[model samples]
Target: MKNNATLCFPAFLIGTLATLFGGEIVSAAIYSITNTTLTVRYDDATQTFSVTETATGQTFLIGGKLEGEAVKATVTGRTIIVTQADGSTASLELRENVPFVFVHKTLRNAGTTTTYIQRVVPLTFTLDLRQPAAEPRTMGTAGLTAPDRRPQHRPDHQQANQAVCSSAG
Candidate 1:
C-alpha cells in the first residue's frame, strides 16, 4: 500500500505555518473576524461618518474613517451625517429628520472570551466637527468680504451661446 499520509503531512505543516506567520509578517494585511471591526460611512458634504460596532450595542459618528479603512460621504442642508460601510450589519444613529450631530466611539467588551479574537483593530474614535454656518451672514463674490479662498469657475457663456445660436440658425 502507498503511504499517502506522509506525503500530505508536509502540506499540512506548511498551511499551519502560513496561518501563524502570514499576518505577523504582513503588517498591513486586512483580516476579517466574523463580527469584529468598526466601520463608518461619511457624508463629506456634512462632514460626518456613521459609526457602529457590528457585534455590540456600541454606535457613533466620526468626521472621517481611520487611516486604513475606506470612507465615503454625502452632504445635506446645514448638517452632514456619516455612515459606516465596512460592516455588513450596523445601525446608524443619525435620524434623517433630526438636526446634524456627531457621535464618538469607545470599545468595551463583556465577559465573552471570543472578544479577544480580533482580526481588526478597534479604536476609540471621537467625532469632532466644525460649523461654518453658525451665524446668519451675507454672501458676496466681488468685495472685501471674500472667503479665505476663491472658487474656480469660468464665466464663459460659450456653450450656452453656441447652443442658442445653433438652435436659432
Candidate 2:
C-alpha cells in the first residue's frame, strides 16, 4: 500500500504539469495616437485608456485607480461621447477610421431666456497601432524611415486650389 501511494502521488503531479503547459497564450497589442494637439493611449487587454487634449491642455483618464478614471466614454452611431464626473462632455465625430471634430455644447440661462452655445474644434491625426515586437516611434515620423514607393492620388493643382478656396467659405 505504501508503494502504491508513492506511485499515485507522482502520477498526479505529472498530470497537473501536463495540464498547465498544454495551452496556447494570446497577447493583445497596445494602440496609440499622438500629434501636436492630442495624445491617446489605449490598452487592448483591459479596454482602458489615458488621453490628453493638448490644445486645451486638458487630460481625460479612465479605467485605472491611480489615474482617477473620472471620465467615461461610449460610442453611439458615428460619434464617441466622453463624459466627465463634473457633467461636462466632449463629443467626437468619427470620419472613416479617425476622429474629425471635437464638439462641446453648453446651455446658459439669463433673464428667463435660455441660450445654447456650441464650440467645434477640428482634429487631424492618424491612428497608430503598435506591433507586438516593435519599438515606439516618434509622432508624424512612423513611416518616414521606409517610405511607401507606391503612387498616391495627386489631384490637379488648379482644381485642388479651387476646392480649397470654395471650402473656406
Candidate 3:
C-alpha cells in the first residue's frame, strides 16, 4: 500500500494557453488565473475548477468539481493549492508571461496503518466542446500565439502526464 500518489497535467499545453490569452486577477471564494488567451479558475467552496477563453467567455469544462471536500485553499503567486480532509492536495499554477497553467495533485494516506486506496479521483469534469474551432499550431521561444479558436477550442491531447510516488514500505 502506497502512502502517496501524484498526478500532474501537461505544463506545455496550459503554458501555451496562458501566453495567448492575457487578463487581470480577481479574488474571492472562486479564484482566477488568466493568461493572454485563457482564464483558469478554482472554486474553493465547491472544490471545482474551470478554464475559459477570455475573448468569448466560453468555458471548456462543464460541471467540473474535485473529488473531495477542500479543507483549506492557499494562493502563492500565480498558483492555487487546495488541501483536502484526507491530507491530499491539488495545485494549479499559472506561469508568468507564458500562457498555460500547471495542474498537479497529490494523494496522501494520513493514517498510521497502511491504507489501501481504492482510487483517488482528483477531479471530475465534463469538457464542454460545443464550439470547437482551434487548429494545431506551435510557436518559437521568442514569440507565441494560440490557435484561432475564437468561439473556442480543445487541447490536442486528452490525457495528462502522471507522476508515480514510491510507497513507504
Structural similarity to truth (TM-score) of each candidate: 0.18, 0.24, 0.59
Off by over 4 Å in 2: 1-70, 95-99, 105-169
lDDT of 3 at 142: 29
What is the C-alpha lDDT profile of model 2 across 1-169, one tens digit per residue? 0110000000000000111234753323334444454545444344344555547745543331111122455445434444445344444332333322333322112223332223222222332233432443432324433234334544654344331101111
58 Cα displacement, candidate 3 (Å): 2.1
Can you give the lDDT of residue 8 in candidate 2? 7
The digit string of per-residue lDDT tens for model 1 on 1-169 reads: 2111100000000000112364464222221111134433443333224444445635543443332232332233322222344321111223333332223222223232323221232223453223343332334564433344445445574343221101111
- Ten consecutive residues with minimal summed lDDT in candidate 3? 12-21
Q: Candidate 2, 40: how far from true, in Å?
A: 9.1
lDDT at 7 for candidate 1? Answer: 7
What lDDT is reached at residue 61 by model 1?
38
Q: Model 1 scores what on Cα lDDT?
A: 0.29
- Best candidate, lDDT: 3
Candidate order (TM-score): 3, 2, 1
- Cα lDDT of candidate 3 equals 0.62
For candidate 2, give the lDDT of residue 123: 21
CA deviation > 4 Å runs, candidate 3: 1-3, 11-28, 96-100, 132-169
lDDT of candidate 2 vs native? 0.33
